[model samples]
Target chain A: MPNLRVHNLTVSLDGFAAGPRQRLEHPLGEGFEGLHEWMFAAMRDRADGKTGIDVEYVERSEENIGATIMGRNMFGPQRGPWQDESWKGWWGDNPPYHNDVFVHTHHLRPSLAMEGGTTFHFTDEPIETVLGRAYEAAAGKDVRIGGGPATIQQYLRAGLIDELHLAIVPELLGRGERLFDNLGDGIDGYRVAELVGSPAVTHARLVRR
Target chain B: MPNLRVHNLTVSLDGFAAGPRQRLEHPLGEGFEGLHEWMFAAMRDRADGKTGIDVEYVERSEENIGATIMGRNMFGPQRGPWQDESWKGWWGDNPPYHNDVFVHTHHLRPSLAMEGGTTFHFTDEPIETVLGRAYEAAAGKDVRIGGGPATIQQYLRAGLIDELHLAIVPELLGRGERLFDNLGDGIDGYRVAELVGSPAVTHARLVRR
Candidate 1:
C-alpha cells in the first residue's frame, strides 16, 4: 500500500503552522507569508535548475501524491454554514493539486470538478471513512494530507499519518494556529529519520515506528 | 565591552523554553527533562571524552561568560514572599555557575556566597540597573543571561541581548512558558547566523543585526 504522508508543512519556530484570523484578504493569515518565504526561494532555485536538499524535498512532495485531504478552512475562509455555492477554492483556475481532493466540511456540497483534472468532494463523514474513500480514489498511489494545521492535528491525533516532513522556519509568529496542540499521546512514537539545515529553514523527516 | 548573551537554552519543538508548573522536585518543570535529554547526552559524551558539535556548543557557553542574570523563577520556586531564609537555590553547595549571579526579584534577600566562586545577589531593580551591576561585576568578560523564559523575554523586549543560542529539541511540550510571547517587536531584526543538527537537537545561533 502507498504510504499516507504529510510533506513540506512549514511551521514557525514557536510551532504555529498558520497565523490566526485567516480570511479572504489574508489567505494564510497575517505575517504568515514570511513562513513560506523560504519555500518560495526554493521554488525559484528549482525554476532556475538548481537542485539541492530543499529542492529535492519540494520535488519529493509531488512524487506519488494521487489524492489529497484538507480541512474546510484550507478550502476557503467561510465559517459556519456555506452561504454561496459560487465560492470555490483559494487557488485560481488550476490548483496545485491535480488529483482528487477530499475536503472535510460539516455542510455538504456536490463534487466540484475543476480544470486540470482536480475534483473537490466535501464530506462530514468520520476521518476513517474519508480516508477509505480517498485511498480508493487514489488507487495504488500515495495520499497526501494537505493542511492548515487543524486538519493535520486531527490526522495526527488519529495516528493515521505514516510519515511527516516538517520545515521549522526561523521566524516566530507568536500568535497563530499551533500545529502541536491538543495532541495527547499522538506524537510519542515518531523519530526524526533525517535532518537537514539550510539558510531558510530546518527540515526534519519524522517516521512513525 | 562585555556582550550580553544567552547560550545553550533548550526549547521544545513549539518554542517553549520551559514546561508548565515548575517546582522543587521538577526543577525544569514536568516533562521538560526531554528537552534537555540532548544536553545530558552531550554531557555523557563529554564525560566519555567524545568531542563533537554538541560538546563544542556546551564548551562555547562557558568560554567568555563572567557574570550571569536570571529571573526569580530560575532562582527558586518560592513566590510572593520568602519566608525561609535557607532557600539558597535549586543547585547545591557548589552551583555550576562559578561567578557573580544577579537574580531579579521583588522581595529583597541578602547575598549568598556558595562553596565555589558563585555568589547570588538579589535585586528589585529594573533590568537595565541589574545589567549595569552585572557588567560592572564582569569587569571585562561577557555577561550571560541565564533564563527561565520570562527573564529572557524581558531582555529581548529591551533589546539588550546581543546574541542567542537556541537549541530546538525533538520533543513537543504542548503547554509551557513560551519564550517568544508578548515581546511585540522584540524578535525582529535578528537572523540565524549558524545552524547545527545532531541526533539529539538542532542548534541555531541568532545574532542581532
Candidate 2:
C-alpha cells in the first residue's frame, strides 16, 4: 500500500486549519501565511532559493508528494451551483497537485486535464472509491491527505490514513470551521515516530501500530 | 466573555485534525488519545477546567457567546438517512451548549430542549440569518462558529468566526476528512495569543485582526 501521510499542514493555534473567508484572493485567510514559516526555515526551502529557514522548509515539504485528494473549495472558491465548472482551482497555471488528484463532488463529471500533470478526477463513486484510487495512484509512495475537513473526516471514519502532519501557527480566528467537531474516533492505534521542532513549524511523524 | 477555547486540542506531527472512524463513542478517534497526552497533561487540562491560571479567563471567552451554532452531525450521529428524528446527541442528558444552539439541517423540526439550559433550533436558514440570531442572542458577546466542518466552512466563507480553539491529536487516519483542504488562503493576519501545553491537549487562542 502507498504509505499514507500528510507531509506538512499548517494550522492556527486557535484550532483553525485554515483562516476565515476562503476566497480566491484570500486563500489562507487574513493572517495564515505566517503559519508555515517553519517550512520556509527548512534547508529544503533554502535550496530552492527560498530565503530564511521558513521558506526553505515550505519548499521541501511539497517534495515527493505522489498524489493528493482535495475538496472542491481547496481547488477554488466557486460555490452554490458552480456556475458551470469553469473554475479550475485557486492555483493559476499549475496547481500544486501536479501529479493526480481525486476531488469529491456530487456532480458527475469526467476527469479534467490541466496544464501540468495534475488531472482532476471527479468521483461521485464515494469516499472509499476515492481512497482506493488515491492509494493506487500513489503506487506505494506517499499519499497526502489533502483536506478541507470533510474529506479528512471521511478517511478518519474509514481508518485509511496512515500518517499525519500539522504545522501549528501562533494565532486564532476564535471562531471558524474548526478542524474537529463531529469527528469520530481518530485512528485508534498509532505512535509518534518523530518530532522535529522549530519556531514556526513542529514536524512529527506517526507510525501505525 | 466566557472563553470557549480549545484547551485540549491535540495534533499529530502529520497535521490531521483528528483521527478516522469518527463516531459518538470514539469522538477523538482510536489511539488518538495518546497523541494528545500533551493537552491532557495536568497543567493544561486544569487551565480549561473550572479553575487554573486562566480560570477567570475561562468561560469568559463564551461571555460574548450569547448563542451557538452547530450542524446536524454535531447535534447527532444519526447517519445513513434522516429516517426520523429518533436519535438525539451523544452528549447524553446534557450537552455543552447551555445557551441557544442553531442546528443547520434540511429537515424541518422543532427546536429541541436539553439539559443545562441548551435549546436546539433546527433550520435550513442561511448562515447570516442564523448568525444574526446567534449574535442577537450573544448580545455583544462573541458568537461561537460551531462545527461539522461544513458548518464551520459556511461561517468561514462568510468570515463570521472571530476566534477559534483547535486541538491537534498526534495520529493519522490517512484517509479521513480534512478541515482545510479547500480553504483558499487558510488563516492569515492572525496572532497566537496563548499556547498552553499539556499531555492531553494543547490549547491555543487565535485572534483575527
Candidate 3:
C-alpha cells in the first residue's frame, strides 16, 4: 500500500506551522522564515553540489510523492470565493510539483494544467475521498499531504497520516495557528523512527505504530 | 560569575512544558509523564549503575546550583493567602533540592526549613530582587531557575537566565502551559550550544551570546 505521508513540515518552537496573517506578501507570515532557514540553507548547499542529512531529507521529501493534496490557503491568499481566476499560485511557470496536485477548496473551479506536466484539481470532498482521488492520481505511488497545519491536523486527528517528518525550529513565533491544537492525545501511538540534529533545526521522523 | 541557568526543562513537540489543569494527583498534569519518560528511565538507570546523555543531563541539572528560584505554583497549588501553613511541599520530610530555594509568591509567608538543607523562602519581591537574595544565599555558587514555565518565562523575558538546557520530547500535548508563550522572538539572542538525541528525548542546550 502507498503510504500517506507528511514531510518536512516546519514548525516554530511553539508548534506554529505558519505564522499569523499569512498573505501574498509574507507567505509564511512575519519572521516565520527563521523556522526554515535550515532548509533554505540546505537547498543552497544542494545547488552548490553538497550532500548531507539535511540535504538528503530535503531531497527525500518529494521522493515517492506522485501526487500532493494541499489546502485552499496554500493555493493562495484569496479566500471566501476566488477573486481572480488568473492566479496560478505562488509558483510561477514550471512549478516544482511536476505531478497531479489536488487542492481542497469549497468553490468550484475548472482543472488547471500548468507547465512541466503539472495539473491542479480543486475539490471540496472529505479527506478520505480526497485521499482516494489522490491515490488514483498517484498511480500506486505515495500521496503527499502538503499541509498548512489545519489540513494536516484534520488528517492527524482522523488517524489518516502514516508517517510524519517534522522540522522543529528553535525559535518562538508567540502567536499563530498552532498545529497540535485539539489533537487530544493524537500523537501517543506514534514513535520516533529517526531523529537528526543540526545547528539550524532538529528533524524528527515519527511513524504510527 | 555565578551563572543563572535553567537545566533539563522538558517540553513537548508543541512546546508545552506541562499539560493542562495541574492538580494534586497529577503534578505535571495528565499524561505529561510521557514527556519525561526519558528522565524517569534515566533516574532508574542511575539507581541501577548506568550513565549516558540522559542520565548525564538529569545529573547535571543539579550540578553546581547552590540556590534555586521557583514560582509559587512550583512550590504548591495553594493560592491566595496560604490556606494551610502546615503544607510544607510535595516533597515529604526532605526535598530533593539541597540548598536555599526561593519561592516567588504574591502573598507573604515565613521561611520553612525542611530536612536535607532545603529551605523554602517565600517572597513577593521582583525576579531581580529575589535573584539578589538567592545570590547572597548561594554564596558565589551558581543559581538555578527551577521552573514551572511561568517562572522561567519571567526570567527568560527579563534576560536574566544565562543558559538554558531544554529537553525536547517527541510527544504532543494538545493543551497545556507553554514555556515559550509570550516569548516574542525571545530566543533570538540564544544559540544552540549542544544537541543530543537519544531514543526518548532530544536535549538542546541554549546559551546566550
- Residue A68 miss distance in model 1 (angstroms): 0.8
lDDT tens digits, residues B112-186, model 1? 999889999999999999999999999899999989789998898888899889898876666678777877677
Off by over 4 Å in 2: A29-34, A37-45, A48-60, A190-195, B1-209
Considering every candidate listed, which one attains the maximal lDDT? 1
How do the predictions measure up, each by TM-score?
Answer: 0.87, 0.51, 0.87
Please give the distance, in angstroms, between residue A1's alpha carbon in candidate 2 and its true position after superposition: 2.7
Each prediction's Cα lDDT score? 0.86, 0.62, 0.84
Of models 1 and 3, which has the larger DockQ? 3
lDDT of 2 by residue, B13-34 (tens): 3445555776777665543456
lDDT value for model 2: 0.62
- DockQ score for model 1: 0.36
| Winner on lDDT (2 vs 3) | 3
Pitting candidate 1 against candidate 2, the one with the higher TM-score is 1
Question: Per-residue lDDT of B90-172 in model 3, one digit per residue for the tens?
Answer: 88989999899999999878899999999999998988999999999999999998889989988887778899998988776
- Order candidates by DockQ, high to low: 3, 1, 2
Superposition error at B116 for model 3 (Å): 2.6
> What does candidate 1's lDDT look like per residue over A76-113, in tens digits?
99998979888889898788899999999998999999
DockQ of each: 0.36, 0.12, 0.40
Model 1, C-alpha of A125: deviation from truth (Å): 3.1
